[model samples]
Target: MSADEDRDATAATPPELETDRELVAIVAVADNGVIGKDGDMPWHIPADLEHFKETTMDHPVIMGRVTYEGILETLGEPLPGRTTVVLTSRNLETPEGAVVAHGLADALEAAETAAREHHDGADRVFVAGGATVYEQLLPAVDRLIVTEVHREPEGDTFFPDWDRETWTETARDEREGFTFAEYVRS
Candidate 1:
C-alpha cells in the first residue's frame, strides 16, 4: 500500500463495536438494601456465595479497593477465568492475578481491554463494589443481580437507589436464607 493511503487509513477512526455484554452490579443486601457493616458483610448466607460464584465465573468484575480485599479474604480470590479490577486512590498494587485501576473510568477501560484480549463477549464487566463505586456506575450498569437477605442488619454501606418504573425484575427465587433478584433496565 502507498504511504499516503496508509497514513489516511491510520488517521481515520474505526467504526465502533457494539458489545452485547453489559456492565452488571452484583451485590448482596438486606430487604432495605444495606450491604456492609464495619467494613464487612453482616450476614452468613451460604446460598448467596454459590450464586455469586456461578454468575461471575468468567467475567471481568470491578470493585473498590476495600471490596476487592474483602472478596480476597472471604471468597479466596476471584475465580481463575475472571479478571478482577480494583479502583482506588491509594498507591496500592494488585495481586498476581488481579489488576489495579485508579477510578471508575480507568476500571472500565481496563475491563474493555480485558474483554478484547480475552475474546469473551458473552460475559459482562461487573461493578461489584463499595457504596461510592456502586453510586458511580449505577447509572451505567445494564443489569443488577441483587441477593436480598431478609434481615435488618446494621450497615454503614447501602446499595444505589433505582426506580421501580425504570427497572424490571427479571427473576425472583428464594434459596435457603436469601432471595436472588435480577433486574434489567427498561
Candidate 2:
C-alpha cells in the first residue's frame, strides 16, 4: 500500500457517544436563599436530610472541599453507598473512601466515571455543594433538587441565583418545615 493508504487505514475512529448522564445539583436553601452558615448547614431539618439521602443514594456525588469537610464534621466521614468526589485547588488529603479532583470539571468527570464503574449504569451525578461549587456547576446542571426551608435563618452561604425561566418545575412535596422541589432544565 502507498504511504497515503497506510495513513488512512491507521486513522482513529471517533469515540462512541457516552450514555446520557444527568448532572443534578442538590441543595437546601432557606426562603432567603441561605444554604449554610460558618461552614455548616444553617438548619437541621430531619425530613430534608432524609429526602437528600434518599435522592442521592447510589449516585456519584461531587462537592467542594468545604462541603466535604462539613459533611465529615456532621456525619463523621464521607457519605456511604455513593462515590464522593471532592473538588479543591489545595493540596488537601482526600477523605477516606473519597476521590479528590482539583477542579469542578475534574470532579464531574470523576463522578461520571464512578457512576459508570460502580453504579450498574446509574445515569445521575449529584452535585452536593458549598456555594462556590454550586455556582461553578450551575451552567451544566441538568436538574436541581432543592429543599426550600420555610424560615430564613442567619447564614453566610447562599445558593446561587438561577433563572427560573430556564428550568421547569417537575415535582414538589410539601413537608412540615420545608418543601422539596425538583426542577429540570428546559
Question: Quick one: best TM-score, which candidate?
Answer: 2
**Which residue window of length 10 is worst by lDDT in model 2?**
8-17
Off by over 4 Å in 2: 1-19
TM-score to true structure, per model: 0.83, 0.87
Predicted candidate 1 versus true structure: per-residue lDDT over 75-109, tens digit per residue? 68654677888888888766655788875567887
Error of 2 at 60 (Å): 0.8
Clashes of each: 0, 0
What lDDT tens digits, residue by residue, belong to model 2 across residues 1-186?
121332221122112212268778899999999999999987787888788889889889989989898888887888988889988878877655689988655776788788888887788998898888777667677789998899979999998888787789999989888888999877
Which residue pairs in candidate 1 collide?
none
| Deviation from native of the Cα of residue 128 in model 1, angstroms | 0.8
lDDT of each: 0.75, 0.79
